[model samples]
Target: MITISGLTKVYESRGRQVTALDGVDLHVREGEVFGVIGQSGAGKSSLIRCVNLLERPTSGTVVVDGVDLTALAGKGRRAGKDLRRARSSIGMVFQHFNLLSSRTVQDNIELPLEILGVSGAERSRRALELLDLVGLADKAKAYPGQLSGGQKQRVGIARALAGEPKVLLSDEATSALDPETTRSILQLLRDLNRQLGLTVLLITHEMDVVKTICDSAALMEKGRVVETGTVGELLATPGSRLATELFPVGGAATGPDRTVIDVTFHGETATQPVISQLSRTYNIDISILGAAMDTVGGRQIGRMRIELPGRYEENVVPVGFLREQGLQIEIVEPQDEARGAAEGEQAEARDARQDESQIDKQDAAPAATAPALVKDGAR
Candidate 1:
């Protein structure tokens, strides 16, 4: 429902040009929660702002539902009437619940309807409907300060939906909330997306938010999109940094004699006891160093780091067996302790052999130093 092509935004500070979004190309499909993740200065906020023309791009287009917002108002600093009308269909939820402290919950939700010239009765009806939709129907009279952070965000979400938007733009809406509250808010977003068939574009530095609710995600770094794809596609893609970050597996230290491998599983493979099968098939004992398992969008996803008894070369067939079972595997370097143990064993074997050689030499020395048995003719 949203298409951003070659979107670039730049600002001036101290007479120097600062680029916030550098040629970002992103697409959000209908009824899907698409997440943009990055660090503090990775241009996540800039990308979201440009989507709604909150920050006009220096170049490129922002098209929502076949309407190009950038083309609505000619390169101007302020939004015109046409741009404002277009923005009404695109709702936004801010990081801080930017509610009017003076207004009650119902008035906060009705503010958008009032701006659109909605009648008092119609506004009241829509406000209550949205309040119920966001699970805050009972808080219509509650003030912002009277509610918890989660409750206030619910009001923010309810207010954003007052205009019946087709697309929802969320800018760190759950950043300030606690972990338990964050999950509830994300679940609410997911439910709203499914119920209303709304397309959502959310930006956050938190990976948990994306993992829990988003079907597709993109990673931004230094004002550029580094990677973008469906969650399953990224997990299957080799060397996918987003996938690795989403499902982090601790690395096990290895040596020349030992093997460390990471195994990834999704779908049907996740239901199988692959580790036990490998142990039974290869007859090699395996040690699990670290693992992460998650149920995302009702699909089981897992990553595990395991250590095998032998080196990669010796366990090549076993690794191949894991691949045959439809698991992604990555071999990691051995740690120092394993390498040191191999060296120590080699040194001890060498010393034992040298000691045996010395004993044999001493036996010969006794024969040589003592009177040897002479031949009979010689005696």
Candidate 2:
């Protein structure tokens, strides 16, 4: 379990203070795979780094497994003995497989134990065990360069687990891999979470990662968490940004006097023919504009945008009837249709600009200035 409160991280760039995290408050429950998703500059990377005290927070408290890491960190630039000990139980996997190039897969995994003063025999045994656990037993003798990207990541996961950590922090662990590899990695994380009871807190820009493996998720924007909740709760929430992004049904009322409504279906309601039932029961023709369906955490979820033959006032009875059948509905106000369309376009343009700016900043930064771990590295 992990809890972060009032977490803020600021950096000096071009003689100006840039806030990477702005008062982020988040909680990850025990044994749950929690995901933090955002675009570039949303502070996801900074938040994960702060969790392990790799990047000390400008102001905040981080508590992991009931221990206040911020208090242990104190005012020191480097982590003290207490904080180091605490970090041993918190494993981290990086975007780039930070494995030692010269070390074999087994050696990379054993390095963490070696630093902890684990005996040679015990380290060897543990390394082999972890390799087997990560399905890399046969690749134990392979060097980092010899392995594929997915294999390298598996080695990284094995290395992170060498300490037998209770929590796993993943910083874009699958972003470098292809789609198939990414799915495999997400499945591996899910398997690890269930088998080892590891509480995973991963940060990614990919939505599929969250939909596939995360039980709960938080959406970040402009260095702040905008939405956080269980997948089910979010899917069932009316006008949920996460839900809309996850299952987008895009269409608007094409003509005046027609009412457009967005409906969310989940749990038992997802299986029923709610739309057909509504139409038949109300004796009204429903025109479906768009629909999307997907399964999350083994439950089917969907959203639909439909157009009714009348204004919101005229369709009130039918909308109420749909609500009675346990569907979340949002009536699109006809008066604000044009304004909302313009605002949506502007938001999209703004997002594109922000993304381009962040990419430029990243490209301009020197590789040598990138953060590196002293010991117990990702690999």
Q: Encode model 2's per-residue lDDT on 1-379: one tens digit a residue.
A: 8999999999999999999999999999999999999999899999999999999999999999999999998786878899999999999999999999999989999999999999999999999998999899999898999999999999999999999999999999999999999989999999999999999999999888988989999999999999999998888787688987889776768889899999988889999988899899889999998899988877888899899998888998999998999999888776556766777799999999999997787677687644543232454
Pick by lDDT: which candidate is best?
2
Write down the TM-score of every candidate: 0.85, 0.88
Report, for every candidate in turn, its global Cα lDDT versus the true structure. 0.89, 0.91
> Alpha carbon lDDT of residue 323, candidate 2?
92
lDDT tens digits, residue span 62-153, model 1: 99998999999676688999999999999999999999999999999999899899999999999999888888889999899899999999
Residue-level lDDT for 319 in candidate 1: 91
In candidate 1, the residue pairs with backbone N, CA or C atoms under 3 Å apart (3 or more residues apart, or in different chains) clash, namely: 253-335, 254-334, 254-335, 255-334
| CA deviation > 4 Å runs, candidate 1 | 333-379
- What's the CA error at residue 331 for candidate 2, in Å? 1.2
